[model samples]
Target: MEAPLDPVSAETVSISADQRSRPYLRLFLISFVLLFAELACIRWFGSTVILLTYFTNIVLMACVLGMSVGCLAASRGRNWINAVLPLGLVAIGLACWTLQAYERGEMSIAAGDQSAPQEIFFGAESVQQAPLGRTYPIEVVAGLFYALIALMFVGLGQVMGRAFNAIPNRVAAYTTNVFGSLVGIAAFALAAALQTPPRVWFALALVPLLGFVTRFRPIQVVALVAILFLVGWLPPARNGAARQVTWSPYYKVVFQPSTAVIETNNIGHQQMASIGNSGAAYLLPHLLNRDAGGRPFEDVLIIGAGSGNDVQAALSQHAKHVDAVEIDPVMASIGRANHPNRPYDDPRVSLHLDDGRSYVRKTSKKYDLIVYALVDSLVLHSGYSSLRLENFLFTEQAYRDIQARLKPGGVFVMYNYFRQGWVVGRLVKMVEKAFHMPPIVISLPYRAKITPDQNQAGATTMLIVGKTEAATAAIREKLAESGAFWIHVSPAKNAALNGYGAKAPEVEGTMKEHWWKIAPSVVETRGIGPLPSDDWPFLYLRSSMIPGLNLWGIVIVAVLSLAILARFAPPATTRPNGRMFFLGAGFMLLETKGVVHLALLFGSTWIVNSIVFFAILVMVLLSNLFVVLVRPRRICWYYGLLIASLVIGAFLPMDSFLALPGASKVILSCAVTFVPIFFAGVIFATEFRDSRHPDVDFGSNIGGVILGGLSENLSLVVGFKHLLLLAAVYYLLSAAFKRRAEPPAS
Candidate 1:
């Protein structure tokens, strides 16, 4: 139906096009220089300290070089088979690597049961264990898979240059990309509330729409940053330093509350939270009853081993062997090097750098006393105002795994930080429900000058003890006879009881006696309870509304409005090539999401969050400056788009991994930071290549990011990390769309 296309010469484009994009090349050089600096940092400091920094540098450098060279090589618009094909291969590699990280399914840091028989009865239970298996080697394989996928994504970016040229009504494509991103974000955000079938479709469609949005205008960047910051600061967002207990008079009320200690090291001196030593000090006396402590504990299992204090204490107890499961590797390393007390030296202590749940599941050996110093609630209890809930850590199945690993008569000790009157009842209820046995609770009141009611005042730590049914009734009777505290017994006969032994809170609706019915089976199996509808003062820490929650639904309508507005406006002053606006926007959004997600993956501190927020802010400010400086020429504008995309792709990861893993938490942070950053850099770079204008590009990119943030929070409701994976794929698809649009000229 079409006239012959003039034999579509392979190298027919103007020489001016190459000249036009040189600025983009120059920008790429700057990006590479930045990455070289990061690489220098890694070389001088060591990988452990600057692990994230290293990867970020590599990703940025690769993306910059790839884009700059690829685009330069194809200035004359070569056919897709020659120019874009190689880039597509690279994108595919990157995508595979990025996606591989979560393919193994997320596991906790603590060790627990691994090979236990699944309960074939429950309908939804199978869904939970579907991905469960020997996942260690699988994890590495998965990483490689994602790496390849990322490569594919990069390749896709190279092909996009040609695709946009073929489309009719270029302005319409720009509007569609922006609108598509907004719609995709809305769809992803809403998927959390809807049923599975509809949500699946939304999740699937979200990827390409995201790809389309990445290629937009710069004004959208500011709007996107505003949205990201809004979501980042959402009340429910998780922060760690928010609730860290400072040294205070009330310290006595909380046994084993952490202390910050400054120590000198080769890397210079810094302060770190010391928890294991304090916990060991508190528990050591009880383990040997202060007897001649040449060696008291024969065998030990330490859950949540902080700073290796418990392991040292166990060593002091001279246990023949100890299985130490510390959830935070950063902390573990600190303990290994500077803990003042090191357990790694002990031949008996075996360090398992696995999640506590999985460790217990895999190991059949039982210990004399299983010390669960940190409970399931603590998993979600970051010391921050942002309510980031580690939802998987608190499920009912976790408790059952613990139960399965314990010897029939083994004692289980946990620390419950609550000192309120009726709160003890709730804790006891949770314990009984999980243990399926009556627990003899005892409160070790730390007698200090502080009052308990002054919640801010540090008081002595009170201990909660629960024993199995096989434990002597005399122990229970003794607990019951202690009239010094209020106690609550369950309705069931001879059921587990809470030895609160204290008066209730004076507030209205506060009751003196404490007993609540809990689903024993649920409690015994998984530590997780039903998601609470109403916020509990002790439990609920933060809140936030998703961005553009209402307006997002009509993004298509909004694009239409923009189209009408564009029709009446001064013809864009300078319109970008085809879908460039959409592609650029997708890259920006993908880069930001990648930074944040990488932070989560590597266990990096909230600094990554700060960088992400700041980068967006900087991007907006810089874009405004460029608009004023460059005066809207097509080549300059296009260069501006390319520069912004490359810089974003390169730098975001650097910000993510600047802080290296030193202590347990630090190591966790390192692990979290790199993967997300690498993937983000790769994906964004790919997307940017296909983007046209700055405004729509920025808008759609930001919209995708907003959706990513929203998805992170909503993960509490959904079961898998698939949502996160989908977000990364969205960027990949954008790259693919670019390739499709730009099929190399034959």
Candidate 2:
């Protein structure tokens, strides 16, 4: 009792204690940083790379690839967490700056009417008039840049995997990792909420580096701070009072003072100039005029009412009341600030920040004029799915619902800069099929001069669909007087108009055929393809084939990932775990489905997506906790529960659920949709708890996410709801390969 311990023994004991605690803290930090980096990439990559705006899952796949490579390194007993992570941050910042410079140069040239060298990586397809030719040199250079960015993420993945391997209790480590991820999501979300730019994100990400580094070098700290500042301080490509660019949760919004217009991702979105101020007096003129009997519209509804332009149009027409629905909060805020008419502030107008389709389905009020403004999205809704923000709005079924919201004699008007003749035909067909009546089509040239390359910018097309022929006739007479050129879309209407000696609108010979012959052929052959529905919402894409650049990019990255895995991952780490892989893939699919389903049921706003993601994480964390606390031994029972939940989800009527009141619908939908996800989480946690080498298993599980991302493309063919069946199949395969274990004695 009196014997004193030696100094060496005491030092060894202290070191042992520190070593035991170190991995836990490191794992948590690594997880937090990994998530932060992923979010940063999503935002930055999507904005810089135009291709990513359409195919966002590529960025997600890159993040997964990096993590998988890191796990391989950990299995090989390699650790470069401290050295590579901070350096990676600096590298990413520099890369972003360089890319922005390149983009600015290209855009400036394009805007000046000079054809810039085509970007080979994104391809010539996006450029309207650019000739299709392979620029191998540009492709090679861009590919290397993409690879470098991917490699930076590998360092983060390695740190997380090594920390996971170091921890004694795998379940505890996993729970901690999930908790850290939650924190990472919250931190990023908070930054976004504050409208803090990329610099703040970099600063937050680098702060964790202080704990990782052993020798605190002042130069390293200075370098890191400088990089953060550089990233934040760098000027955007397009910057001026004429152009105001801001980051929104959904898009990079650009407002032009000259035109008083707001564009998203270089695509014309909304004309901010009020009718009274702008020379475009012909725009929505029919809406301004009295009805068939010269009666004024009592109420009007404007969906996709961006920048309050349509609301102002309704107000100028002296409508008693106007309901304006705009999905994006940022757009609404901008409208409130900038709209010269101040229509949103008008007593007659009620602004609803909601999904257009959801609003039409749930609202009790009916309107005399239901105007579908330029409700088109330039980007996908989520990275995983092909669904766009306005996918639900253009569906055939959606048109029917919109028609129901209109009074008996009320007219439904939809107009957009439908560039492709086939796209215009598809919309015309959709509206005709919904109402069983031919819609009046009007095509007008852009009010301002535009280059041939800016064809979409140079034309405005309108479709006027009426609940009755009398209503249609009333609008037709008004539009006829406004010098609007009518294009016959429906076969019966086309024949009747021709017999009446109504000449087709004068245009380029090729363009005339495109509108008359080619347009109708598109509908006749059904070659314009499946009209977007709730089940399959991809309004922009005509075919199931992934775009050329997207396909190539995916293939290249996949090949590169496989090469890295084969070269660095040890043979022992490559052992097949079908159960884990399948579970992981299924879980990812389920998560994607949940997000899209909830977005449709609630709204496609960023807040809804964030809540869904956060809720999923919480469910997964709780499942892991349940596995630890209860130590549930009946794995089969959990599997059964998972299958049952999926069955219910598959057969459950989404329309009926959507019919419920908004609050009740959101709550019930969450419960129904997430129940399967909860059970799936339980199954994953239970199996993970039993894994002997969780680092290897965890890496494999993440690998499954890659496959899941690839499978998400199936939504293009099968539609989204059917994706649950595909997910169930993966789960079944997982259960088939699962190893049996005896229940623990109570």
Candidate 3:
């Protein structure tokens, strides 16, 4: 019923709802479904199986391969959407269990090893074993899942492809598709922020999938239910019980009620324990500070203060104030409610759920003591190698930032069961370089041959650095008087400490004598290890190179992509539009550079990550809008601007953005990061509008994007800044390819 604007006016205006064309609605639905499904699978597969954490790129590549094939095959005029999706979901669910983090035999990729100059998966360092009877190689397992995931997306892509073909104005269709994707990302992100369960995510996906299905038979109904069951399947415990799992923005967190142990992605993450009852290592820095300076710490800061063990320890030491910074909110929540000591509940403790380095950089307060306690997470970047949640927390630049926030005589301590001695040596060197003084070191289970220990690196080692040389001098003097840098509490104290928790690491004969050994010189500390900079904050990596596992993954994905293209692509246009393909490839890298740059300028928090993604799409949308409104025919201008922006971005390093004032930083960073992408999008939309076959061009573009994803590995060798140059090469090639393929009429 329509109401009149004015009561006095007898003339009633009839208003009818502007109908959205069915093809556009279908396009929106399919695009929304594809994005949600892709994100859901990426987040779920890694968290559920745990083994797939390192192989996330495979899942990503598989989606690209599938969609590429599906879109390319749309010309054949056949309905690709059928019962295949649910069947594919079944296969994926089965793959999650058949392959896992650990089994009868160890499963590890190149990053699995604890050696130098190799990619490092942080939380995967601990030796793992499962009760299974047999196992397959990592290569074989990764390959199997890659093919399965790709097959599932093939059907969805074809449906979306057909939708695109139905629309006459390709620009309008592209806008709707991008807008749908934006909505999908925002919705999924909101669901994650709300800490919705896996079932909710799958349910959200099921809504769109049901729309595409033609049949509602009993078998199809069963298939839909089965998909929910598979994705929401909880990891079963050893005693045939399912552990309660919580979905964090980052990972699937499982907390053991009895042991107070918290696990992420089925791997042991942290424990809520008391220092008075076996967490003595947590007090070492304060003890060292007190013994050296004969004063208690007034203000303390604990980065990576997982589950409040560190915070509780600070309180136990009688700190006046404690600032605990933890990245994962779910981890902090469990710590607050479950930790026996109630650290987070303490009046002195203030918990901040944020990225550690980011917190440290922003806080104006200076601390007498700062602790980096056992901070590690398994968060690999989709485009880069072995990036963890805590990666930026350990870089030389990060250390400098921490040092700036320290009180004049403040002492900084970071302790971890760092799997390798080289890791320790690298860390020590970084601290020394940043602080301008060699830090005091305490390596538990210390031994001769500094480069030895079968890569054990003296498990549970601690490195202590003072803000200045004078503070460090006092620490050294106290250590010298104490005979050794180790702690040797009486047997009674040791027993009391172990009463409430697991036994802390102890030296062989440490009832009264030394509990630690004097660290060796830089030479014995291990041959000049490379320092981690802001540009390359890969603390766990041995060096800047792609790990072997990823190398094989890229090759495998490329090969499978080729095979799929050959099989499903139409004979007439089997090859993708090369120009569009190259543009897609280059744009992917351009997009990564934007994300990495902003991540560096700000912090790599989930919020920041999501915003960067949204912003990138927004830029694309804006550029596409310009093309749709203006309808520019010439592409040469955009190519020039795109290349110029790439060059500007490449030369302007991320570190420069760090010093800018708050408002300026946001403004300049966005311009530098988003401008190139904006230009790139304009070029793509212009070409897309001109394409005779949108499906083929799009498929080709996706295929090229896969190649760009592959080239991201080179960032390991050249670093993120140089990636712009590589992207520029691709853009130039794209322009050249277009010029040669379709010359302007003379």
lDDT of each: 0.34, 0.66, 0.73
Candidate 2 global lDDT: 0.66
lDDT by residue for model 2 over 534-572, one digit each (tens)?
667666555655544445555776777677677667545
Kindly indicate the candidate among 1 and 3 with the higher lDDT: 3
Worst 10 residues of 3 by lDDT: 1-10
Question: Residue by residue across 1-746, what tens digits does model 1's lDDT show?
Answer: 21121223434344366753543333332222222222222221111111111122223222332332222222233332232223323433333232232233332111111112110011111112324333232223222322322232222223332232332222223233333333333433233223122214312432222233334455334433332232112111011222211111001001111333321110111233233323422342233222211234466787766457666656655578888875444445556765655577778888865455546655779765666543322211121111222222233444555666666555565543333322333344545667775444443333322221222112112322323564323334433454232212221111122322333323333344442111111112122223222111122111122223212322322343244224322225423222333334334334433443433433222333334433433443343334334323223234343434434433343223323333654454333433343333333333333333323332233333323432333323332223334443444444444322231234
Candidate 3 to truth, TM = 0.90
By lDDT, the better pick of 2 and 3 is: 3
Candidate number that wins on TM-score, 1 or 2: 2
**Tens-digit lDDT track for model 3 on 1-746?**
21111122112123222333777899998898888888888888777654577667667777887888898887775555675556566665665555343422334333344444355555554433333443344556677777877888887888888788766566778888899899888988898899998778877876677778765566656777777777766645544433568899988888878777787876677877656756667766666555455477879999888888888877887899999998889988998888888888888988998888778877899998889988877665442333556767777888899899999988888988777666777888888889998877776665544462237533677788888877667667755565444444332253322211122335455543433343322214555346777677776666677777778777787777777777778445666787888998898888778777777767777788889888988998999888867777678888898899888888886788887888999999999889888899998887776555778878888878788888987877777888899999998988887432321111
Residue 505 of model 3 has an lDDT of 38
lDDT for 344 (candidate 1): 75
TM-score (all chains, Cα) for each model: 0.40, 0.82, 0.90
Give the poorly placed runs of model 3, Cα more than 4 Å off.
Answer: 1-20, 99-117, 123-132, 215-217, 239-242, 381-386, 452-454, 485-529, 570-573, 739-746
* Top lDDT prediction, candidate number: 3
Error of 1 at 533 (Å): 14
> Which 10 residues in a row give candidate 1 its minimum summed lDDT?
245-254
Q: Against the true structure, what is every candidate's RMSD?
A: 20.6, 8.0, 6.6
